[model samples]
Target: MIQKDSAMKLPVLFLGHGSPMNAVRDTPYSRNWRRLGQALRQRYGGEIRAVLAVSAHWCTDGTAVTAMPKPRTIHDFGGFPQELFDVRYPAPGSPELAAEIRSLLGGHAVAADFGWGLDHGTWGVLCHVFPEADIPVVQLSLNVNLDAPAHFALARRLAPLREQGVLIVGSGDIVHNLRLMDRRAPDEAGSAYEWAESARSLVNGWLENGDTQALTDEAAYPPALHLAAPTPEHWWPLLYAAGAAGADEPLQIFNDDIVGKSLSMTSVVFGHDALFEAV
Candidate 1:
């Protein structure tokens, strides 16, 4: 079993995993992920016990945590290259962590799930972050029935895990509008449409200002919300990261770029300023 130090509180991360192709491609985002991983090991001295991933892909009727010892690498997407499909993240799963999470959110009826494995959202980012696949990973499912505030409250219950040396990660894009994505547009900042850029800027402002209420209030961005996040699945993961963060913890934003005109590759790290310094 991995040892944990109560004094060593791990940082929380919300990664905007743009596409499955990033798993195999060497883009700026992928390189940043690698640097971030190196910085994490350097800052924490390789003491991170496990990762609790809240991915956008795994949504269920109710909340659940992956408990199986060995989690399969699920492609979970199509139209990708055969090489991408073949790429496996062979990370182990922690049943103990799953049980701990279930205990943490006891009132939520969180199930011990064995049916689902590491989907693209989780593995795609981890493949670049912790490529060795040695750390145990447990994924928590997003309860579809929960509203924005309830999701944030549910995530707040997971705050204790950070003190136990568990790195909580929420993997999903802040602005993920698949329908509006311009395939021909170059994957670079300033290549996005006016609306997409505006939406991204608005969300970034909220994050920077520590305005959790504005971030959770769907009605706050009305017409922009319709364009930026048509659906809440991708956007909800951000709340998990934000909610898990302590009120006093410093928030750092990275990979602040918009790709394909509609996808914002903005990621956030809560606490551990030293890690960013190292990166």
Candidate 2:
């Protein structure tokens, strides 16, 4: 069956989009993202139909997907440099893909949003991924009303799109606690707190073992989760990718690093070895 074949299917990705500045900065994170994007074509060997992005920035009342013809690049964050604010990703929106998503997720309360556009959680990484901005993208808002389990089930419904050339990307941090960052630490570059690493390791084990239940089970994780994810919005995207992953898909973590002492820049790809093998 086509569903069982990796050659014709698109892989899923979970990107830790640390900061909006990475969109314009030539940092290590951005460099890795660019390399991974190039690897997608060489390793996957299929034409990309479109990109279906589930970003942490777009937390909606209900599930929504951007249906505009030309979606605007929204600098959703504040306190960034002027250059970062000037940066814009001119990626076109895909109404056809949006309609397809609406049909795929039948009876799931999916909305076609003309107002919302690509936020930093998306374009920040996408600008590095596909710099040409030639590919059409549709942003799916993470329904704030739903929990991790619900999000997981929601993403699973779109699994069929993988075989149709839609790249499913979940953009958020695994460990994102801005307040927990230690500014006092010297050489603040890519420094991780003990709690952050512990939380990452705990969650990594779940991902490696394909333990979706333990990942969503609130009681199963350690207290480090509190520090790792003070709010679940950022961490929730991981569950989306996890749900979209095949039952026995090969999962690999790359660009694994902790930034700002709390935020984790660890990114993962399912059903591909290029990103890891290249490095």
Candidate 3:
């Protein structure tokens, strides 16, 4: 069983980072992220030792962790404005933390990755969250070979880091279907396709009720799963955040809106109620 230390335990975040533009644009989503960061600093002060990020964009045949001391800001997507590409989050990387993470998930044979740096899924949201980029950040890659249950099981091993002041963050959209996106649609709640809204609601219900099993089980998914996800990479990061959280921890939902007619910006936090107040 994963042990919990209430006093020192940090919260787990699953942020739905929709577009690379959000990193530079001053939208409500980015504003909330900035507020969330301020709230974290206000509450935890310098106790936030490091960040362990699991991003949808970083997927590998097997699990891996970024080990480079000075990781570069990666611009993985194309067609974005030059301003977005120019944006850099110069966060320091922590090899010690990466090694510790590999040690924690020793069963998975997690590799030390020096090549892959912080992709948009990690840096895009983090550039707003911890704007200063002073904290050491280490990214864990999503193993495409593993199923949702397997990913969750692997993430459970890292729960102990919470007590050590590690902020575990999973960056991905709850419902992401790029092909069906309607760019003209307003970015707000209830503006998505019916299937997308249904899918988001179903997942939110499971999260709110603490039904982690339903989330991982394919049979429990709605019929719109194909339209909602299209591919599992984006949805899989949520499992990591849910798995690392204490079973009984209170969950707070934020930025629960859908944009582009196919992307859901529903974010959740396990523990740290003050953050909800901040945003």
Q: How does each model score on TM-score?
A: 0.95, 0.93, 0.95
The ten-residue window of minimal lDDT in model 2 covers 1-10
Q: Report lDDT (CA) for all predictions.
A: 0.88, 0.84, 0.88
Model 1 compared with the native: what TM-score?
0.95
lDDT of 2: 0.84
Poorly placed runs, candidate 2 (over 4 Å): 1-7, 184-191, 276-279
Runs in model 1 deviating more than 4 A are 1-4, 186-188, 277-279
- Residue pairs with backbone overlap in model 2: none
Q: In candidate 3, what residue range of length 10 has the lowest lDDT sum? A: 1-10
Task: For model 1, name the residue pairs that clash.
Answer: none
Residue 156 lDDT (model 1): 93
Q: Between candidates 2 and 3, which one is better according to lDDT?
A: 3
